[model samples]
Target chain A: MTTREIILARLRAALAPAPAPVEAPREYRRDAPVDLDRLVDRLTDYRAHVHRVAEPAVADTVAAILPAGATVVVPPALPPAWLPATVTARSDDDLDHTTIAAADGVITAAAVAIADTGTVILDGSPDQGRRVLSLLPDLHICVIRTAQVVANVPQALSRLTPHRPLTWISGPSATSDIELNRVEGVHGPRTLHLILLP
Target chain B: MSRTFLGMPTTAPKGVGHLRGAEPFPAAARRALSDAQLRRNLGHATATIRAKSGAVVAEVPDWEQLRAAGSAIKADAMARLPELLEQLEQRVTDAGGVVHWAADANEANAIVVDLVRATGSDRVIKVKSMVTQEIGLNEALEAAGIAPVETDLAELIVQLGEDRPSHILVPAIHRNRAEIREIFLRAMPGVDPGLTDEPAVLAAAARRFLRQTFLSTPVAVSGANFAVAETGTLAVVESEGNGRMCLTLPRTLITVMGVEKVVPTWRDLEVFLQLLPRASTGERMNPYTSMWTGVSPGDGPQEFHLVLLDNGRSAVLADEVGRQALHCIRCSACLNVCPVYERTGGHAYGSVYPGPIGAVLSPQLTGVADNASLPYASSLCGACYDACPVKINIPELLVHLRDQAPHPRGESAAMAAAAYAMDHPALYAAAQRATRLSRLTGRRGRGLPPPLSGWTADRDLPEPPAQTFRQWWASR
Candidate 1:
């Protein structure tokens, strides 16, 4: 046998046999009753923003965190929030470096979302604008739907195809190694707010 | 041979002082068995890094493509490394910079200490370079009466704390704000009397402390993120401006980088530019990416010394399957995602390099003969491989190293027996049948013999089923 074949044979013997083929690798499960407070704390540790968005609850959350007439970013395909129509959002259209950097924040919907790892997938297209907008912004308010969330990375990957561009977000951007020291806001958002819907 | 990676003192005893009777990884892990503080620190730090990396990485549309590009670029760099090194040597020589080649860590250290001593400087400011750490540069410098002051904020914390780094990206990740405050209060030469653990407060204190070193220090040391063969440029990326200070301000700058750190051209940087920043700090772009080509006139440092240290990298490079490790961007994304690193922290690994990348990379560099137990330091979880942007199959490499490495004593022979048993069908079947007795005791199975007892010490081996799967298959 060739070297590749020999190696593959050894690897095949090493690994447990592949499980009987399943129709789909995706295994959807209902959200278990996670302690919201614990979830918030855990997500916050990762620089995630947590706010309840049950109709009346969301507007209050947004208003509480952001001041009036504050520039908030939203995708063209975003769910409507009660912000005044006049409060202009920088859409993901004609998004050059200059325009994106100038904006206060840019929000986008997730692709294959993971709840176990608490990640949201954003594939940079029109809505996700080059991945720089969400990263550079001082504050990012991510919109996550219940159905969008999967249990684990495997499930998330199964839902995602290789064709589309995909970005998986779990928490805020931070670094700790300058002193074995943890420093957030090195290159990404110092603040991360996640909008969760039931 | 040049010992470029292992920076030990000539004055020190030739033999390794401790770890003679040190049990394998599992036995050493017993010391940390009750250390809750270490666990808490590691767990919190790794989880946080993972979350942040997940967040920004999710926003990118072409992240996979970018990863592929990064992997391809690194692969390209590795495949033609010898040619590139020769090219880089010619280029660096053509430029004003002096290039030194060392085959191992000892040669690298001797060359550097001699050069620094020749310059008659007792102190040198340092940029946070893993190569220097791997070579034990600080300790080596201290032995030679040269103080290598770390200028990076995080690096400053680790240096002052007199502590080893835990996470690659966040070396002092074990330190909380309150702990940092305590470290500063004790170590800083003229630390603020009443310092809080506030990140900004700590940062200000470090900045104040290092500002003098940055301005006055005549000699500087650093490791490169990428070395360009085309222009002989050394690239370093950092969040704080300290790395910039180390790279510039000083009259004499010495960069000790691994042979693997070289990239072929300037444009190849585009792939790593995206791959490294996001994978490391979880950023779109590193805050400060400073690149210097040889020595510039009337610009930064005039005298540039590039020490190309082989250490044991040639052995690693020789292995076709294992050479992919050289492709590491040093992003530390793997460590963030690794459960083992999250529990043990970097210190338990007993090396400058830690975590999954460190587990493979350090042993490869330092020679597994010296630190034989390190390869098994991890649980072979593929979390690191999944997280690696360049797709380094780190777990596979770890197992491969453990198999190939000679034991410091006769420990490797024991593993050989285990490997034999696993590879042999009858032995595996017999072992499975022997394990069948534990079925009677269920999950609380005990009395499994010496090495088997080691397995039961930490975890209950899965009780054999009423019928072995083989039995069922045979009957069917």
Candidate 2:
């Protein structure tokens, strides 16, 4: 059989619908044109910022949140002003695992966020940086542009390919291993903070 | 590698599907529920990941649509896999990377062994790779008297403890920090004897332990998350730098990639890069995502080899009901959310491929006629189906297997008994009423009866509904 025919047959067998499609169409638990304001309001558990502002003030916002004496992991190619002077930060290339593990909070720019799912996208770009810095630190503060938010996975796919490397972040690295009881901050960051800069 | 490579043992056979998926999930689950410790670890891990995944996924206005696109793209690719693979091989070869087509597990292992031997290297540091694990590359090398050092921290701990991976993303998810410290003490050649269970301390211990391997190892073996046919580029995404070290420092790099990992173009990578980490480790981006095309002149590894193994994949494709299994990315997100996997752990799946993906993938790879036990490994509750990003109907496939497979006589007997009860409404009523009596034909208590004990063995059956729906309907 032709390869296309074989693939369709396999899918047909896997589905085995009597007439109409057995697999349900994609679902959304949220109302259409979902509440972005409400979503961003509650997205992060940590103290956060949800202001409608320009891209340039990211440094000031991050600076306000970072406490004194907190070590920050800045991606090697980050915009210098994205971070405040109060935080002692190292470049992504120079920082080791030890420095990341000891740091109080991590801050980085995001690739995109899906409002429907309350998720963020990270590619290995200077803007998004590497995965470890966001993961190892106890707290994470992410900066996002409103325009980057897409409505669905399909639209997002149109923007991506197997070009380089990409990473997707939802909330934080957590486990529910302790007695079916959830304990965050075991392996990855315990607290997640997101900033929506319009 | 600049240094010579070692070979696999002569006559080392690829165990292949000689063995079925011998999972101990049911038994392991029963024991894990009570161990408080294991449950605690899993519960905490899954809950945090779930919430995080849910949140980040929410940020995407079209997350579900994206999942659909991702699933559809993979489905579309699988139909044209052969052509894509040939295209991938041509591109890699044209770009100067040696492409080895391995027909089966043994052939893949032997080819890798010979490749390493050709390099004249006896020892190689390895990045955490599921393909090599599936092929038993380490064991094959060890039998040939080579030590393949695991550089990924979790993998190193697992190797040291001689333990199986419990979770896909966190291979050592079963062990607590205290247990990890113990493993380090017993396994490390000369690790800090008084290390604490603190994450910092453990990170330090692993860092010191791996530093030498990173600087000294001449060869590294890896698995690619995505192979871009357009650019002949192979990519490895990770939260730790060890994967980068393996991709670089080594003189020769060998990648074991499943034939299904190829994507048509580089631009298509955006969808997966966005989906993978959030699905696997709940990260926005992996710590290190290194991409290289074939062999480079003065940069990174001077020599490169890509071994594409079919193993049982072609066999899987031949079966109409099972071929969708190839769309899997091995992200382990399904494993994390699956109640079955939560309790049974990865080792219970009985193979390098674990979780729901493994359940479907293994049975198909090995064939339903052989690994029949795997399909029955689930409750068919459809949790796995819900968790799968590719929309693979794992539960439905499981039932299909059940129908196609010759059920063990025990299962057939059990199913027959169940069918009998359902067929005869009066008999079902009587049995349901009778089961409320806890006595095994001995006591006068209301609980569970003897004949139906197996169904309620690990679970508490609903105290036979106080009133049958039929009786209520009759009265009405």
**What is each predicted model's overall lDDT from 0 to 1?**
0.66, 0.66
Report the poorest 10 consecutive residues by lDDT, candidate 1 chain B.
B9-18
What is candidate 2's lDDT per residue for B1-476, written digit by digit as tens?
21111111011123542224454446545665677777777676777777777666556655566578667667656666656677787878876788887655687788788877877888888888887887788988987877899877778878999987676667788777778889988989888788887665676677667766766667889998888777787888765456766776678889998777887766556567667766766544443466677765544577889988666675566556666778787778788778877776666677667777877777677666655667777888887777676677788787877787765566578889989998998888887777656345333222445555544565654444566676688799
Count clashes in each candidate, considering only residues at least 3 apart in sequence or on different chains: 34, 77
Residues A109-160, candidate 2: write the lDDT tens digits: 8776665335666655676665556655667777777777764444554554
TM-score of chain A of each: 0.70, 0.71
Sequence-dependent TM-score of model 2: 0.68
For every candidate, give the share of true A-B contacts it also has: 0.05, 0.04
lDDT of 1 by residue, A99-121 (tens): 55456666665665554445566
Q: What docking grade applies to model 1?
A: incorrect
